[model samples]
Target chain A: MNRRDFKIISEWIKKESTVLDLGCGDSTLLNYLVASKDINGYGLEKDIEKVQESIKKDISVIQADFNVGLEQYFENNFFDYAIMTQALQENKNPDRIILEMLRVAKEGIVTFPNMGFWKNRFQLGFLGRMPISKSLPNNWFDTPNIHLCTFEDFERLCRDLKIKIIEKKVLNNSYSTNFFLKLFPNLFGEIALYRFEKTN
Target chain B: MENKFDKKSVGIVVPKTAEIKHSLSLDCGKVLEKFSLVFETYGKLNKEKSNAILICHALSGDHHAAGYHSNDDKKPGWWDSCIGPGKPFDTNKFFIVSLNNLGGCMGSTGPNTTNIETGIEYGPDFPIVTVNDWVNSQKLLADFLEIEKWACVVGGSLGGMQALQWAISYPDKIKNSIIVAAAAKLSAQNIAFNEVARQAIITDPEFHDGHYNKFGVIPKRGLSIARMLGHITYLSDDSMRQKFGRDLREGKLHFGYDVDFQVESYLRYQAQAFVDRFDANTYLLMTKALDYFDPAKDHGGELFKAFKNTESKFLVISFTSDWRFSPAKSHEIVKALLKARKNVSYAEIEANQGHDAFLMPIPHYFNVLRNFMENL
Candidate 1:
């Protein structure tokens, strides 16, 4: 949604790490990471125009679908970090794809819009309709986010899957967290960014 | 978007012949004591003889890849769309060379050329030449031109296969390779189509086992049938539907096997025109080479291993509707290049022209080509 998530992801990534950016639309984050961290990596995108843009930026990108999985194309543990920015909910199976990412990389970083935010709750509970807040802008019928998840729901999934959450960042609409967000992130936080590793 | 390199700028260019007296060894272990090659060159080679780019021609394609052969000729070379001054190939920046393959019907030594020893047309007796053979012959031309290494070797379809072979055969001799709409090997279905075309040519009574040249007769019917079949594979269903569809040629169906459908009339015209210029034996050899191409076979059944020793960077392009050499086929090559850790860029353009889309002036396709050539 903003450069905040990209900056946080870049901070988590180490210099010279081999990274793979999933659904790297136009490769804005990947390009930033390359310039800041000097990382060697590739961006996997599905749109032809986005892939071409990445090429123009001198980023190595492969035009592919994230739903089909990356098992056949990339080697195991070849990447140091697999980053997905605001695209986890759009995945057909987030759990399976995250596991797939862990298989190819040692660590995985993902960001998603928090459906349990206060505004969304107020819209769905008081208005008696699907929320259409700043974070969830699309209408209920046309939204690309198939699996809307809250901060707690994501943490619960990590615990269930035994994935180690190395770090977590919760942000509001302006991409900065306040005391209210720290106290009740599931209610106040509009976006959640996580850095995790597979225990297995 | 000015079309600076238009038809009028096609300017005077002619094919030149080079006779190599050295005995060349083929991949099939055959030997040709001597041979001749027909080629055309545009742009000047620098003093260091370095800025050379070789354009390989596909099946039925000859040395005339760009520019007019004579002032009166109405049509330029087949790939004039992308080759010229300030174009993707950019004659201003590089020396462009295109040659008729060894087994082609063009001025090069092919089925129509006279055998050195027999003093008769080689016809069907011409030894089978593989992609490797073509690359070897091109090297002779490179040597004669004083180019120690080509800046790039580019081709589409069968020509693309030769480009791949060039990188594999002499990794140090080619700096870059542009392979479009080509595969490492043909599929079973692909081989089946070629087999049908070959059958059409050989079964004709006039063929007489490819000695029609000596009998002062041409297997026009058989060649026409083969060309007609090849034309179908070169185009996609959507392309054919858009171009001809079920429209009647005379506004009413004859219903008697006469050219009723407009598509039938189009195919008939294409076949007849092809028969007038091409030889049947060359068609047979071209298909045979396509079937025999399998660079991965000798490399432990792994396409990646085939590129392990390749030193040249590659730019691979494929079209969406090119069922003859689908995007999946192009992916096979791209994936192998990646596995081998070679520098590669791939693009699958949206197109409805099928295999022939590589020859068309698709804006995005040309943009990628131009960018790649400029960067190289």
Candidate 2:
């Protein structure tokens, strides 16, 4: 839904490389990538209607839950990249699922709302309630974001897992941050996108 | 062109020229004197003698593969679709000959046919027959018709099993083999269905140890139950759901044991109508023959070895929805044929008609058969 994040992902994909988009709701990103880059892209969407929509577009998709891990359905290193956008926090085992994506693909791209944004922290501290913003809107009970994380937490986890961060970008809605994001991304940005390659 | 025969039992004046001759043969050093032999031919033969095609029938089918008797008002043969003038088989161009299997209830002799020595019907006493035995008996018929080799051997279902056997038993005697909706080995589920059908037949009180004639009664109920059970397997779950979901018959639920569901009514109608034309002993014999069929057994365990020496080109067709003899089984046949280095073409057509799809008017089935015949 974020145009800036879409542009960043679109520019990162290599020409003619195989791609798989996990939790590919409606398969919009993969469809766009396939049409423009001549990429052979597949989508994994769990919703029946979304699967039907993908089929109508003639895009190959398997309806499955990504949280269970991707080992049973695909071989190791089956794709060039596994992309997950606004979908990481919804997973039950986000860390293990990320490791599986890394195992299946040469690289993994994950984008999620920045929980430690200054506005979210200030609202939580002063109001004594969960923050609701443009990126994270739902109340705590009805929200799909069970394992929410901030940019710093994700980077530390990536470091402990020894995954090399190839590229990183922070966005305030559709606009990417300039030098402010590199200095203090959690305070200035509302969403964070990271592309990491398996180091070992 | 029409010769009439007076059948005593049914008092049915059928065609005399279509007389199917029967004989008791002593094979394996007279230890097994089973009912076996050749049947009559209808049309004339071509000059080159290479225009012959052997037509094998399915379960509960007989040598009456085509044509109707002048006196009897029954319809033409079962496979009249592909076995007539200007049809895919084109009786005009090919000389077709069908055989009653070794364990069938037709004029050739089966469980219901009287055993000469015992002066009673063979019934359950009939020795277990293999598909190989059916092919071996057809050899006699081929000889009787003066056919050195067949241009092609075509069959479907159990008939397809016989066609495969013909290819393996006398490889040199065939040029092409068409096997439809058949398998090299029966699956566990298929065997289980047959077991249930057999149980239905044997459990009836009127069966009387396969000697119901002593009580002047036939196990029609048991036979009908068996047919009902067999009929269910002949259709796919999707087809059944589409044809008869939870739809009730004529009236609302009385909560009695009467036929309530439309499927039940349909199965009952099928079972009742089937009894009029078929015999109970025949059902048992034919099913037993199917159960004993293991084409790979003769080749020491490797199925490919069975077709190793065969030179016949094969065309194996399977229907997607035919779960009774699924496409996977057809693939097994094709895989073995491929490994044997035989020329084989396979098509698993998408159809919802289930195992009965082979007998139905599916365009893809006809088109594929037509194309294959033209190329041949």
Candidate 3:
């Protein structure tokens, strides 16, 4: 009930709107949204144990691999927002999934680690190995981040996909950077959060 | 695994009641009819009794709900898991009574019984009995026993239909009702299955229009085939695969259709064994009764209206793999019950066992039943 992510998600969501949380592990965020914000939320998680936990908490979750596409569930403009926190880079086709999220929802919210942060760039340039930082925690072989990208790379891809960014924030650990993110986001930010609307 | 007992004893020894009588009479207007009630009670009935449970039997079921007879090799009747001394419907606290239905062949006045007028077996000439008739006879038995109302009435399959009828007909007679693997009305497919079985019986050469007894013959093959078909409906395909796949009877295939497959041989044995105890005419009559069952039809075609007056708590159970009376049918029942604003709990158990899952000792069924009964 008092988790930091739950608090952040609760504050971010508006009252009484349709929400779909992708990779919503155990549905704690959705449950919080349902109880506190009065938002109708459904979760999609791949792990069986997490799905069971979600069910035990009386949360509606469909256990499926979201990378295969959610065509069965959502038609165009089905949800007010599709939230993917700490899960965009883990997908097999991150860019395609992002487009699908935008296609399904009026707006898409994505959060991921900033791979072009100074520490990661320093580790890759000086050490000549994969960056193992606080945000990206896995070693080379067992890591789930296959197509990790920087904040600037996501902005370029968003431009190419004709998606307009409504708002963007960068987080250093749990604190949001107000000034530094707007100035030099690719270097100073450790995590990038963006809200975008599909234009194409 | 067979137990030795006296075949001619007429009654099995029960634990309670100083001298237990076998038959109880109910005057159905013109004739004085008797009900064949075989019950084994484990506890005492208190004054102003509030702890009585009446167990109802399904199709092809009898009154032996728990324990073994000294001579009978067959196991106790179905629902033994929930009716034992310390089980959910614990006999230690409640007085349990199970009766053989009026048209049942198992020591009941069915087609096998003799009619007083002709001094011959009733056979096919017995009057068509409805679920109401069965419940009426149970009412007589309850009156004879001096029991005012039952704490609960629990049953499965056809037994479930009777339980629903009891709740609708005599709303105040029961406090709780548990209906498992049942429907408010028999579907067209179910009716078709029964029709096929009836045709199988009457078409047999030896049937002779239910007068085969005169010729010292019985419709064994026809009845066996009917039973084989009915048995297939009672089980799921997954259960069949787990039981007997394509394994041969002996070493190799017979190359002809003489029971080469193990499942074929097993079904044949089941059919033949069933013919020994069950009467063919009774089978036809019971199947017809089940076919004609329409609780909703009686109330101007509104099922929820039929249950509008019921104040009893309900527990409706359906198995996931039972295609005969599937979970969808149970959901229909639930929808009607919900419309009536009655307190109802439902569980569609995940099991490979088909409609007969209510009779099996699956833990999921046991847990749900136990929880419901204990809460009541």
Candidate 4:
């Protein structure tokens, strides 16, 4: 929950609306939202220790397994927004999870590491080894990011799911944007943040 | 009483009886005329009176929630683990109030007390009390203390049910509700367990139709058997095995009905101790209260509907191995709160101690509770 990413997500969310954060580890973002935006926020995390930390911050958190889905916990369109920050790539069923998010919330926000960055491509194509950059900072076998993808792949997923992209931010490992990264987001952007809604 | 006290304890204190000037119209359609409530308070009531917390007790629990009655007393209160200074309840930060519920025998107006109208003890005629009656009566105690609202109402098991009732009955008066190891309503199996315990007391030859006290003979056999049965339900099979396995008491069987295993001796000893202290008529009333608690009943059998008007935030906890009020029960509460769009935190703690785990100072459980209390 760096200041830059927090600024982007905070800008996207409306003040005083209900928010549900998926896989909200420690609830740092929701804690900020509660203080700044005064939004009614909740975190859904699996780990008990993280859940306890989140609760300590006065953030409402529900301890639940991510794979089992949210059908049992919430009704459709129960929240104004469902946000998953830098955790989309770690999910086992990325497509189903996004769709479930859209079903439970009126809008969805997501961020993930882009696999098609120049450094990652160079490591894979030129050096013939798995990429180990700051954005994706783990060995291929040890990484929790099972569904790591490019900006292009994510937009394609949005298109396939009939999810209209409201806004998209292409940032580097340090969460900043430049002219070059904006011009060639698919090739140079190391991470991506997207806000989307169903097309009806 | 002014001597130095343990930092971990609420220290030696005496229970006080509050006279309720107003008559209580119970849920059973009986009016309790001019009753009194025995309670113990830990921590100071701040100038704003905003730090008050009411501790609701489960069945078999009394006003002795924390601290000892005297300096030489061997044991502290029932919830001494989490109610002292710097503990979860945090006596230093919050004004803690624990009361013996109506129909309880611990110096509270109950079956063991004499009726004002009649010159006799109420005995079996105590008028079956419910969770609703208890909450309304507790409100009288709050009025007596001149407190405007409670910071939180906390309880485990039957006490948890009262916490739920408070959120539903007096939503605005409570800022938070911490319900641990409790259910909205008793499962059919749970009612059966209570029924068996009641029968154990009722079928005793010396019970004398709930007037054993007047007959100068207590229903020791019946009440002891009831305690033995309840003690089993409070413990997990694994915990029982770890505490007392197949090891014989004397390293060999007596071969008759003379305590073959360590568990038998332990159960007998525990049951006898309980029988000596607890009243059988009060036990019957408490079980009935546990049986009758159903906040959802008035809301068309929908628990979420019952929570629709709740203004307070919630923290519901459950233990993994607690078969009496398992994690599944807590899930029902959390799900209902979610359905009602209320702010709630749910923790399904991994514990090996069964229903009794809620009473112990399990590190993870205490960690979560302390964090929640700190924020409050």
The candidate maximizing TM-score is 4
Q: Which 10-residue window of candidate 3 chain A scores lowest in summed lDDT?
A: A55-64
The candidates' interface RMSDs, in order, read 2.0, 12.7, 8.8, 0.6
DockQ of each model against the real complex?
0.35, 0.02, 0.05, 0.80
Worst 10 residues of 3 chain B by lDDT: B15-24
What is model 3's C-alpha RMSD?
Answer: 9.1
Q: Of models 1 and 2, which has the larger DockQ? A: 1
| Structural similarity to truth (TM-score) of each candidate | 0.91, 0.61, 0.64, 0.96
Off by over 4 Å in 3: A1-200, B1-43, B71-74
Q: Write the per-residue lDDT of candidate 2 for residues B226-307, one digit (tens) a residue.
A: 9998888889999999999989997588688998889989999999898877777778767876787887987787888999
> Mind giving the per-residue lDDT tens digits that candidate 3 earns over A1-200?
66554556566668987788898887788888888888867677766566556655555555456774265445577678899989988878888998899877888888899999989999999999889998999998999898899999999999988999987777776645658766888998998778888886
Question: Least lDDT summed over 10 consecutive residues: which range in candidate 1 chain B?
Answer: B1-10
Model 1 over residues B43-91: C-alpha lDDT tens digits?
7888877889999999889998888766567878999889888789988
RMSD of each: 3.1, 12.7, 9.1, 1.7
How displaced is residue A120 in candidate 4, in Å? 2.2
Poorly placed runs, candidate 1 (over 4 Å): A1-4, A69-72, A126-129, A172-188, B1-10, B44-50
Q: Could you give candidate 4's per-residue lDDT for residues B126-153 as a string of tens digits? A: 8999999999999999999998899999
Which segments of model 4 are wrong by more than 4 Å? Answer: B2-5
lDDT of 1 by residue, A98-192 (tens): 88889889999999999999989998899989999888899989999898899988999999889999999999977888999999999999999
Clashing pairs in model 4, backbone N/Cα/C closer than 3 A: none
What's the CA error at residue B28 for candidate 3, in Å?
13
Q: Write the per-residue lDDT of candidate 4 for residues A57-143, one digit (tens) a residue.
A: 999999887656386788899999999998889988899999999999999999899999999999999999999999888998899
Instruction: List the candidate 2 regions with Cα displacement exceeding 4 Å.
Output: A1-200, B1-44, B71-74
